[model samples]
Target: MPSILLCPQDTAVFTREYLNGWYSLSAYYASKLTSDLPMLLICPTLFTTIIYIMTSQPDVFARFAMCWGVSLILAIVGHFMGLAFGSTFDLQMAILLVPGLSIPFMIFSGFFIRIHELSAIFRPLCDISFYRYTMEALMQAIYGYDRPDLECHVEFCYFKSPSKLLKELDMLGDLYGHDSGITN
Candidate 1:
């Protein structure tokens, strides 16, 4: 966030976009605070681990499968990114920035509504969200997936897939019964 905003004008490149443009970008960086990634991962990992460990009649592997599964991983990774260098944690800025930043993303991540169906403030979040991108990635991986959904999904966006995921899922359905749910 600040990287885009706080670039020293003399040190940074400009394409005659104009002085006002540079000023606005710099102001935005000055007003931003970064979200700490390692801290965020630490908190959730502890919660999931505790929940997985504490529940009696526990199946450790099953708990991981259920709780820390692909969807959660996708969401967590998205969080690390969206908040990475997001804004300064100042209360004054945070007061507006926190809700301004997150509530919309929460609403847009398809947990609340489909992309085509959003309204008001939420509509913008959908347009800009990395979560939306990541969600598409997850949907692609599991859907019509090959034997490699695990590797590709955990590695997340690193690999490029030229094949359509739905096509893979469709082909998989032919080779294996769709009802088994074992392809993933």
Candidate 2:
């Protein structure tokens, strides 16, 4: 959303500057991207740290790192998506379109419906949905690698077993690398 505002607000200035031969297109793009890098890295790191601590998640460093990494990547992707829409359309249209397009991805993120449960016609959509990959990667980081069972304060905790929860989510596999597009 920040990038969305940036594009519309900067488009006129960029066009004028470019036309006046102040800088080349590549330079302008490079500067814009680099300027956002610090915000991209720092915001996600701080947000992930706060949430990870507040949620009382596992005390494992690897798990925390994975979550933070995924969060940072997601933030960058979302920023670029907004930037694209903002550049392509007017402010109002971009504002409407961002959430309009995001709803489907959210629906197919394996939270509302399992990827396996999705119909064949909609399978392609699930494949393209970053949310699915994000969810899978996060789940793997938090619960996979033979992690131990959760401490259940209540006597009847159904998903104290991470494997069971993963299975129910249709994410019980060595899919962390696949989801993250990184091989071990």
Candidate 3:
């Protein structure tokens, strides 16, 4: 979502391509936005629909809506990135910068790396990641205490309940109690 959809558009809009063009830059961006609308809608709809159905999760519509909401947010972030940065090269640099920024986010996403084990310095950054909220909400929806129990080997017996495992990783939150009208 960083610059994949908007980098070329950014280059076209910010450079001489738009300088000699007839349309205003804002109009150009508007057109660019319109051009991307279909894929944005279609891809997320299909993606979320498929994953929700195939995975057979409870609260199907909620998960679909949450995933779509995240897709839209990330798409908007990418679109604004094109508007904010000056060049495709800068966008590329921003792409590289993303992994550095995102690695901490990913680590704190409560999936791969354990949030409790992380040093305190990264706590603030973890909270800042857009992925954090979505992951939290998704996990809350799919793995709350009331949901089905998980099975594991003797050494992994503690994972019998998803909420227990989440608690062990410091991924549990008050989000479950607050009906967010989407994932939670």
Per-residue alpha-carbon lDDT of model 1 for 117-170, expressed as tens digits? 666756777766645544454344333233333234354553334245444322
Task: State the C-alpha lDDT per candidate.
Answer: 0.45, 0.91, 0.63
- Tens-digit lDDT string for candidate 3 (25-121): 7886688679878876787678767777787666656655665666566556545654454243465666666556657677676567656667898
**Model 1 regions more than 4 Å off:** 1-41, 50-90, 116-124, 130-184
Top model number, lDDT: 2
TM match of model 1 to true structure? 0.34
Model 2 steric clash pairs: none
Model 3 regions lying over 4 Å from their true place: 1-14, 78-95, 145-162, 173-184
State the TM-score for model 3.
0.68
Candidate 2, lDDT over the whole model: 0.91
For candidate 2, report its TM-score.
0.95
